[model samples]
Target: MAVPRQSEAQEYIEKQRIMELFDNITAQLVFHRPDNPKTFMIDYVEKLKESRTTQLDFPCLFDESNIESVFGMLDPTKKGFITSEQYKESTQTLGCDNVDPSPAGSDMDMITQDTFRREVKTGLKKASATFEQV
Candidate 1:
């Protein structure tokens, strides 16, 4: 088989890692909006800026850049909003060509990734510590 280009390998690694992160974010993301859309957005933003996992190895919860990227995850157009219809459409093509912009809105259907994210962490305390350091 032909060797994959260096950039290709790097891209693969990064994609795999971020996809895993997205899976984890989905867990909290689901509970995020149950009561209030306004607070949910603020809460979600805070969670990203401030990691709260018990493990320390995962990405920092609130890395502004990652949070911003997460904000743009589904918004290729960069409009900064997602709707229920747009949310549902994303699940059909995750891990395939279907999920191009990465569904900036929602992905509860792909909870398998959430499981992976939890497994990667050791404890909420440890995870929280990691977020504070940054």
Candidate 2:
């Protein structure tokens, strides 16, 4: 038996990332819980449209102070660097899941705060670009 191909509607939804958009909107609604859901959705979609037209600064979505705080939490001893696994976990926690967790250069097991920040920002920008393309 052969697998059936997706219907045109399903293909369109996948191609245009409609489900992802809807999921994001739904998540926002649940998180914010505005009194006027209709108005909130309208504004949310409008902002999304505007963002697509403008140059959004993806890195700004995560504040520098907050990133530093996360890094500090992961490196409680005030160590200048964290293990690669910790770096990967922290970046994923920060919503940069696409980032490569390996440390740069010959140091295969450690990531400094500066390196983490740079990689996270780069990953965010790349993710934003991919989303916009969709």
Candidate 3:
């Protein structure tokens, strides 16, 4: 059966959802860096095919301290936040080639500490749900 065409709004929402998924997947790959990349990739793909709702166990707890440390690094001035330029510069200074310098999520200009913490928690939740315990 042919599916009905999606409206522009629907398309935009779908794109946003896909982007968020990719962001979550990227976080998992980068932060976790599974011991066996090939096996992890194969398993991850297979799991996705089987069910996007698949739940996987994560060995480590997503601690707030880790999030705070990262945010502190990004906000060296202790101004309680980091602008896009600062984020870009700091990441570059740290030699993070894969990370995007721009502020992530809905905020395109700056990232407050609270926002950063929330995002980190959300990403950790996504990673926990999407990845398997090894």
Candidate 4:
């Protein structure tokens, strides 16, 4: 979409935040260096960036300031990242958290590191997937 202009301050800010999150995630995933995996989570941001052909996407939120929206949608309390307990709560709320892969499945939701990237895609928009449906 040509990138929303400053008039859409809200939109611009949100995109920036999402990008920041993507960068943070990209760095983290790069650190872990998981084995050849089909899905993301460990490589969410980088994969998405490659998938989208742009460095402006995150798996956490579609918008930056709206990251809390994800917390609300997934976590709700705004306490921050998902821990074991918080993950359970997120599963109940997100329902689809199970769609992610978790070899351990001990995290209460059968979610593995791969799930984070899939769901975060919920909020991101790559030039390629922009026309995609939810």
Query: What's each prediction's TM-score?
Result: 0.26, 0.69, 0.39, 0.25
Ranking by TM-score: 2, 3, 1, 4
Show model 1 residue runs off by greater than 4 Å: 1-16, 31-33, 37-42, 52-134
Give the number of the best model, judged by TM-score.
Answer: 2
Candidate 3 has its poorest 10 consecutive residues by lDDT at 52-61
lDDT of 3 at 125: 50
Error of 1 at 21 (Å): 2.8
Model 4 over residues 28-90: C-alpha lDDT tens digits? 457655675435564564555565555444343234444345455554554334454444455
Superposed model 2: Cα runs more than 4 Å off? 1-5, 57-62, 101-106, 124-134
Q: lDDT tens string, model 3, 40-70?
A: 6566556654544544433223477976888
Model 2, residue pairs in steric clash: none
The candidate that achieves the highest lDDT relative to the unseen native structure: 2
**lDDT (Cα, tens digit) per residue for candidate 2, span 1-134:** 66556796687777676775776677668878999999987877776666666746431245567778888998899978888888777777766767875657216676888887778777655544324364
All-Cα superposition RMSD per candidate: 16.0, 4.8, 9.3, 13.4
> RMSD of candidate 1 to the true fold?
16.0
